[model samples]
Target: MAKPARIRLAGTIAATALCAAAATEAAAQTPPDDSIVLNQQLQLGDVFSHQTLNVVDAQEQVTVSTSAQGNSASGAVENGSITVQSDQDMRGDAVAGTDMTFGGDTWGVVNATTQAQGNYLAVSAYDSDLTVDATQSNTGSLVSATSQLGDDDARLLGGAYINASAISNTVAMYGEGSFVGGTIDQSSSATVRAYNRIETQYIPAEAVIDSQAIVNAVQVTSGQTSGQNLAIVQTSTGAFVEAESSANSGNAWDLAGRARATANQAVLYNEGGSVVADSRQDNTAFVRAAATTTAFDFGRAEAHARGAANELSIGNNDIYVEIDNSQFNSGGVDVTATFSGANGYDVYVGADAVGNSVIGYSCSDCGGYLEARNSQTNDGDVSARADTTVAGSTRAVITGANSVGNSATFHVSRPSH
Candidate 1:
């Protein structure tokens, strides 16, 4: 009986110990939903003196990771200041389904990452006498960041950085001092808008920059613009344009290898400049005077129109050209420059028709007019009363098949009653 009692007691003690261990494990496995919420708003008042931590929080649907592994740091967020001496590195990442918002500021070193769909991110950083960096990569998304620096000096770099294939993204930078040394690179097919209004700087090769407006001193670039529109470049003191093109075709404003503009009349100037408009189709070039006191001044304006069966036409304006050289083909109407200001002028020299076809027109006034099928090249007669002297002759040249060409050519001829 004594032996049995001892054995029973031993069994009872072993069972109690097993039950205690199981209870301990059950308590430890409780969900950490509340702890995660508290850490989200955690702040440090000051010096984190020699505190080592490797924390990992992984939940079923979401996760928050915080790590610090290196030296000396001092900074503040919402009146909370933290200073760390001797090696410190921090990394925090969050992932979810709907959206994610992230923020950080480090005097030591920091790295952050996030992944989600249909999200927005706004991050900022300030560093003193230290190096700061940020990187991001995403698709079908949008991101924006703004950073500032103090006198101590800070550097920021970004990579592949922002990708939003089917969305729009904006990145802006503002600085009080200067870019002592830093770089920002952003690339995407989707539209990107960057505003850098620094005093003056240099932008070298394949650097794409777009802003609604820019005020700068010097710029060097090789660029191209298409689509029928207007390109306005404004400078307070002076403006310059040096350009060259291969071809321009189709429409009322097809400025192929040309430079033109409209401006105030009082102080109009075009020094050491050239404007060339080549019209290779029917009624291809026309200039309209937007102002009444039209002061036209062109330095070295040479307009050329050449090719089989092409025509160049000009309209109402005051034009003063230092050197004007116009070229045309046998089946092409070389020059047709005309103005109708009670005092308009005409300066042109070339064929009267294109291959057996004659171009003619009859006009009672500017408002009432009727043109012939072949009159596209016909320079019939010009009648005008103006204060300025006008000198030019209208003639017909038989470059088309002489056997098939017709001509009742007349210059300044009014039919007699």
Candidate 2:
């Protein structure tokens, strides 16, 4: 649950020396050892390595996220490699809601959120990565909140949200709980509340979310994920990977909802309200919990909607909202591979991977997809895979292998309503 970054000039600085002063501060903040710590110091923010770290902490209790709640919203782009690392043996507020990145093999990352008080919020991405990462033990909470007030004839909306994406880049994140996810909920509602318990997914080229689109008096929430989990990894591109033998990762996404856009509304009084939630996660990038090790990550979503109240309420009232959670862990190899390669020959994947599987499946409210496969024996492109419910979890497991290693159990819980 990261917020939009807070950037303000406290004291006045000579504009002429701003560059020199900033450089000096960045240099002084470098870690003595290769190890680093990312902490959010209460309400004032934290002091950290500015050169290698980039954070986005934005909060709008009144209106909009980091976007235009009326029309369209977008994210910026980076042109170099980057690395995100967090070391926490204990699962406290070591590095709560924050984003930090250094230079490396990966390039470009985006974290975006939006709300539409007029119609519906639209989300799309291209040539970059959009996701959320979480790794925790014992217990933790990550939350994001957005709000909309007043009344209008914007009760329900309709449309198609995405098309295609372009790109070229790599990514890597290491720590206790590692997770990567991109989700969108589009279920129509009517009975004063909309229901969104369906996920229509397809990955002929890349892992994507495309469902029915609409806007209305609907509120959506996600990620109230909780569980015990763990992930240990050791990956590299050298000759061979030598170390242990057991590797494991667990992950989850809970998509539950329902929506009704056009229903019987006795406008004489009111038209009710609409609510939705999607893809809740519970896991970490790296860590060792006291009670368990099989780190867990989760994401939950639901939606309810209806048409604008006609002459009933003297007028019509409508609210539209949309959201998605993005994440990734590895050399940006496991998950990024699924998003980049069109040929499907994940050439760089190596070793005995436990919970590093890409699940691109969806079902109606009645069915689910849960599967777990062990490839450590032969160990093909990847190591393991599982098909559970929309309530999916991502846990990592690494053996002694040649590549980048990441162990995580991240609970990236950010609910916006």
Candidate 3:
């Protein structure tokens, strides 16, 4: 009774409906062992997990978390084009342009996000580590990451613009073991901005016996240079060293070292290094923006020798400091000895020469012996009266209202050494 054209049309509709049902059932099954190749299009539900996704060789489009999971959703277009409607947390490695919008928290450990030419962003990790360990043949640009390590003994290494919010507290034995080690080299620029605090637990025997710890922060900016830019050392016996441009580069060295509440029992040495500003031009080297370029800064080169019979040496034309903010044992002779700087400023030179400058002031509660030399060309201003002492040696040029030039004066008593 039906026409031939109508019969054919009915059969086509039935076939299409059956195919759609079958596809839905297939998606509900376990994740595909191989790659989820979609030549046309594919849509997924709210949950996606326990799957290793490889998008490097994909030319198709696949969307996940369409509707809404709780109050948020996530879907990725290309490598970097990942979008999230609400707050979401992603834990894994994603390529460039994996656009992500999280209304909550993200933690990243051993993850790599490379931004070839466009913009990129990454966030948090639990036990995962994010590594951006690229070679000299690679070029990375416009990459931004905000990361936090929530588990103990976790590490995050590599890349630029990296924000590390936390370090682990678990005990582990290995060389160069820190909660975080961010290494950005080979013409790389890294900026670590954080709003939270990073904590690390102390290991007694392993830390106390180690002579020197290569423990510091690596942070560099603007110029292309090798090694670390910023270095921060928190625990154990280690030296926090940061180096920028070379002294012979004819340019100002962009190097800085900052520390607070760092406890250690370490021995450090500065063999024959010099911190010289380009006397050729009005260039600036070893400067403090908090003070300015011309303030004649102190402690550009610092040494922390805080143990029994420890020694700290500073070369000529170097800034050295020894901050004593640790719980030291009694009868332990922690020495902070400084060599003179270049230009005859070695240990506070005369008006014609730039000698070493000593600035020591202690509160009444701070109990330590304060000694200074070459106060004649400089003034020894002591505010606290806790029996301070400044003994000028035979080879030492001691002055002030008390010695050499009327420039050196020390109110603290000293035993004639």
Note each model's CA RMSD in angstroms: 30.9, 27.7, 26.3
Model 1's lDDT to the true fold? 0.18
In model 3, the worst 10-residue window by lDDT is 286-295
lDDT of each: 0.18, 0.18, 0.18
Tens digits of per-residue lDDT, candidate 1, 241-274, equal: 1111111111101111111111100011111111
Clashes of each: 12, 135, 52
Q: Which stretches of candidate 3 lie over 4 Å from their true place?
A: 1-5, 28-417
- On a 0 to 100 scale, what is the lDDT of residue 311 in model 2? 6
- Model 2 segments more than 4 A misplaced: 1-83, 87-146, 152-417
